[model samples]
Target: MESSSAAQSVVETWSAEATSLAGAFRVVARHHPDDIAVKDEENVLGYRELDDLSDRIAARLRARGAVDGQLVGVVIDRSVSTPAALLGVLKAGCAYVPLDPAYPESRLRHAVGDCALEIVVGDPKTVDQCGLGALRVVDPGAGHDGGAPPAGEIEADASAYVIYTSGSTGLPKGCVVSHGNVLALLRHTLPLFDVGPADRWTLFHSACFDFSVWELWGALLTGATAVCVPAETARAPEEFLDLLERERVTVLSQVPSAFRALCRMAGAAAPDLSLRYVVFGGESLDLDLVGEFVRHTAPRPPVMVNMYGITETTVHSTIRFLTGQDLDGKGTAPVGRPLPHVVISLRDRDMRPVPAGEAGEMYIAGEGVAKGYLNRPELTAERFLTLDTDDGPRRFYRTGDLGRETESGELEYLGRNDQQVKVRGFRIEPGEIETALRDHPTVRDAAVIAHDSAQGATLLACVVLRDGEPGRPAEAALRRHLATRLPAHMVPRRFAFLDDLPLTLSGKLDRNALLGLAGAGRNGRP
Candidate 1:
């Protein structure tokens, strides 16, 4: 490993073992067949049971005409059946597309249509809700969901899964994750976390979100138990704590939003548990919020990590841990260094590496970088691109995120560069405007959406009223309020009142839908 700067710590990278996702599961099954691999309140399955069910699912898929290179859809909740459905698809040699059972019909239909999925595996009890025909369905009633040989010696480059992310341009596209990418991620991360057979990982993320990709399979790869938390209970404060204590959870990862919710059960209701590790991702974490949680939880776990990554680079790339001392004085925690087999580079517009401490687009190149998007070659080229860093020809993903390296050599988060607003022949980031709005006394959550009309685009602010908001402020007064904090051009042109901002299935702000509503109002259609 070579240093990019004299002050920064350099991480080493080298070739390591990589294999198909299913192959990783077999290692656990062989070593810990009786260890509880997955569990929900109603059901539980050990490594042997999970592996056999996956084999049966694969056999069922093969019986119904599934083949490699084809895609199969799995519509289910976070349950024992999920791993089996995923394994079956992989075992049958086709990539599995996971669909949240609760997704809006239109969104679910999009993946089905785009992937041309024919065989769907789910619980027969709830298959009616999916309402798709021209496809064969496999449910829990199907016999012998286990006992088939592993798909032998498959290439690491095979498509392991296809995850669809909300498209900023308004068309959701599926990013194809390869076996090599996942294998690389697990291999690199295993040592960082020091996970082993003694650990029990809490599957805390939604199946649709990329974090679940790590939470579900990461434990399996390391020969640890993946204790399941059903989606319903995972989000509920009281129930979630109970699950953690009851299951004896050792490893946990979730979003700041979840931590906020769990903080409600502080006193005697919170889990009477001791976790070895607790990690957070999925959204920006404010130092203030993290402080509140640490203070409330008291004797916190040793492994409190802030991780960062997107679906295009497997699940997570960087991780940083915090000790009790680190949070005593509130400060933004740095997302730690990159995992093994991965390299993080800061590059400018023309793909040239930037000097340390200069803000630029964050580029990620590594063993776990996804091959590309499914059937989206143009987008694949646009996002997953090439760069010539000092190391070598690197296949880098232009992580739309803007970041700067500190004098300490740690990467600092700046917002997104193309999340744009144009005024006076200059483009500005709306995140800056929203950050100011969120500080208003009467605002709970604020989102700014850019509207493009014949006269070009303007920013509109959507505000969720605080608990006791003083009704709606006069438009002029609102502008005056913003003027004190931001430049005149950055003031929101129109303010819309919402009890809550719309969110995607993954619990992220749905800016696309907000802009659509704004357009309808502009035309006086509402």
Candidate 2:
């Protein structure tokens, strides 16, 4: 076996030569032509086969008059075609804008109009259902005349994709990521692991979420297999666990809330798994539940890593490996050091660096920083600023997340600055209260949201109880449990019991949905 350092050196050497994502994938395909590149329920494709299919896709796009740097919309389901369509778009020198078919018609319409998309590649049925009939649609499954792809060299700075994230103004904003940005992320991060062509990775996230960017490219660029998980299988814990075990997946990435359900099922079933890495992202992880999971895994557990990142700064920024010792301490969740090409600094509202152990907004500056939000120049200018550094000057994206550095030099996520709510003159972070609630033996998961009534704003907690528990804990008892760990004012005023918390399509906590549920007061009491 090669030494870890030697493996890392090899990865670094080859990755440095890569310019565009499609170009890098072509290099891998040339070397491992017969290797499995992707697989779905209906089809299995080898590297060379997928390459040829994508070339045809590029040929079709060129025939449709797509020019370099133009935006092409992709409205497809999660399957073998998804990767081919995305790769085809990039290979044709056009950036892809993923439009999930599941999104509402209005949201889809907004994305289409905002991007000024002229052509879309999608399943005919899905395109019709999404009401995108105005734009020309190219079916990925349709047959095309065999022809060589357009000959051209794509620049590293060229846009690869535009991912739309929810905006505070009740609309969606797109972030433009370039080929170099993604290459930098892979070059710095992939060398840390011992992955090879034999490994199988799961594409569990939707194409719309930035997490899928990591999942898809991480496998393809490294000559590994990407097993496309069906939408229904991804939502069902039991089915997802079976798929992992049956497929012998090696690398699994999930949002913390989604993993909690899988962990619970795994604790009971104890199915044999082949996972080497279980990466957590998309939300704050509950360390108490992590401890429980570690204990259940016993003698040997997969390397569980909690990654803190934002869509604008690629998929990952800081990474912390979770060990038993980390759970033994009372310290907050640590999101570890930055990736090799990334720089992280915590600063106050005035852009001054805060003292160590003091909470401040996180500002990221590095090769992985994206080009900026699409078409919204004012918003982009406000969020992405250039700061003077010892190295002269560098651009940084101001992340609204709050964090503090520990004495050990690792970052501990303190929750989002916007999530802080004030109740009766006391500013409270609901994450702290939710953490306290999860620490209780009977509580499995918890979400706290501020609800405003005619009288005033108050904190309401929606909780999921652990399985096999005798009965629901009284509201007063739950409150007393929280009182011991939190300040009196931080305790929630209303308590609600839920079978499971509402989650967005990206597997994140739906705060808006939670607030609505709290208002309904289903199985809740003051």
Among these predictions, the greatest lDDT belongs to 2
TM-score of each: 0.85, 0.96
For residues 11-110, what per-residue lDDT tens digits would candidate 1 score against the true structure? 1111222267776677557767998778766788888998888888888787777777678888767777887788778877888888887877788888
Clashing pairs in 2: none
RMSD (Å) of each candidate, 1 decimal: 5.4, 1.9
lDDT of each: 0.73, 0.86
Q: Write the per-residue lDDT of candidate 2 for residues 55-143, one digit (tens) a residue.
A: 98888888888889999999968799999999999998999999988889999999999999999998878898899988888888887
Residue pairs in collision within model 1:
52-146, 56-145, 56-146
Q: Report the error of model 2 at residue 313, Å.
A: 0.3
